[model samples]
Target: MAKHLDLEEQEQLDEIKHFWKQYGNAITWVLIAVLGAYAAWNGYQYWQRSQASQAAAMYDEVEKVSREGDADKLQRAFDDMKSRFASTAYAPQAGLLVAKTLYESGKVDGAKAALTWVAEKSADAGYASVGRLRLAGLLMDSKAYDEALKVLDTGMTEEFAALQADRRGDILLAQGKKPEAKEQYLKAFKAFDDRTDYRRLVMVKLNSLGVDPLADAAAPVAADKGAASK
Candidate 1:
């Protein structure tokens, strides 16, 4: 029985050796690939975390210059942030902050440049929308109505649809295109939520154009009532 057991153990050992001889390279390669990928993922996570920490510190530097209203210093800080950490969310935010400081410090051209960077380079759609909106407003201030409209058309998300329409109305009104402006105001009025006070402001705009969106809203109900009576 002891001899039989020893023979059986030797056979099992030989089978395991044969299996490893056949598949050892393939198994080793698979493990290497998996472990390499895991190590790379960990490295990426560490790198991203490091980037965010540095970006936050840099943004605080930008905020300091912005608060000081030193457009030049703010621009320098923003430039550094853009160069070092453009992929971080802080970069676009720093751009916007720099633009605000530049504009308030009487640097209209610099403001436009900074805003343009945010509008054109920001990864977040909401951030891009805000950048475009502000950029358009600045262009409108310059009486570049067509260019402002063009900028607005570049990208405006659904959440800002009503604001985009309202802005277009303002630009049209500035261009003395009252009829076209009224049309845009009508669109804005339609887009605004009824519960929002902003809708009331849009209502005022529609009323100024000799239009009443709420009155039109009541028309449907009136028609329904007439049908019921009949």
Candidate 2:
């Protein structure tokens, strides 16, 4: 058989060759980039899962140690989680647990340190907010009023706004600043939803201050009724 193609076939073969010649390298590079990105994404997912699993195990150890009332062992376990898997959600959870346990065990400084780490170092914003709030409360209990106020000022998210305001009011009341305390309580009352038990507590605080939340609105109605009678 002859090696040469017929006219139509040769022209079609030439077009195919030209097409590949123009696009072949570009197609290969695009495929390489896509595959590389897919592989990297899968690797990252696997790494995240591994980190979470290991962190969870460490947290379980911390919990057990806390239950056994071995504060030293609990601290060590928390330290491991913080050092090795701080990127995982479980690490922050463990930090909170450790702080609570330490505080209950009368380890005030240890509790403060743990909360500080979660506040300053945790990647989760919600956890950071919790840490900041708890830290502020501890500082207030220790009578570091200005320091507590400063801690409360930063890093709390809006979801914790009511609690933050209420805590500030408590600190102010502790310092004998009744006017400032009432102002903060009013803010907390407004921030907390009406149905929440916490809001009821705020209402009680306002009542003690002789400022009923509904009183302002009721005053106008009572005045209107009196004027109408006159």
lDDT of 2 by residue, 1-230 (tens): 24455777888989999999999899999999999999999999999888888778888888889899888988889989888998888888999999999999999999999999999999998999999999999999999999999988988899999999999999999999999999999999888887899998998988998989878648999999999999
Number of backbone-clashing residue pairs for each candidate, in the order shown: 0, 0
lDDT of each: 0.91, 0.91
TM-score of each: 0.94, 0.91
Q: Any runs in candidate 2 off by more than 4 Å, and if so which?
A: 1-5, 220-230
lDDT tens digits, residues 42-135, model 1?
A: 9999999999999999999999888888777788898899889988899889888888889988999999999998898887778888899999
User: Could you say which candidate leads in lDDT?
Assistant: 2
Kindly provide the TM-score of model 2 when superposed on the true structure, using C-alpha atoms: 0.91
How displaced is residue 106 in candidate 1, in Å? Answer: 1.2
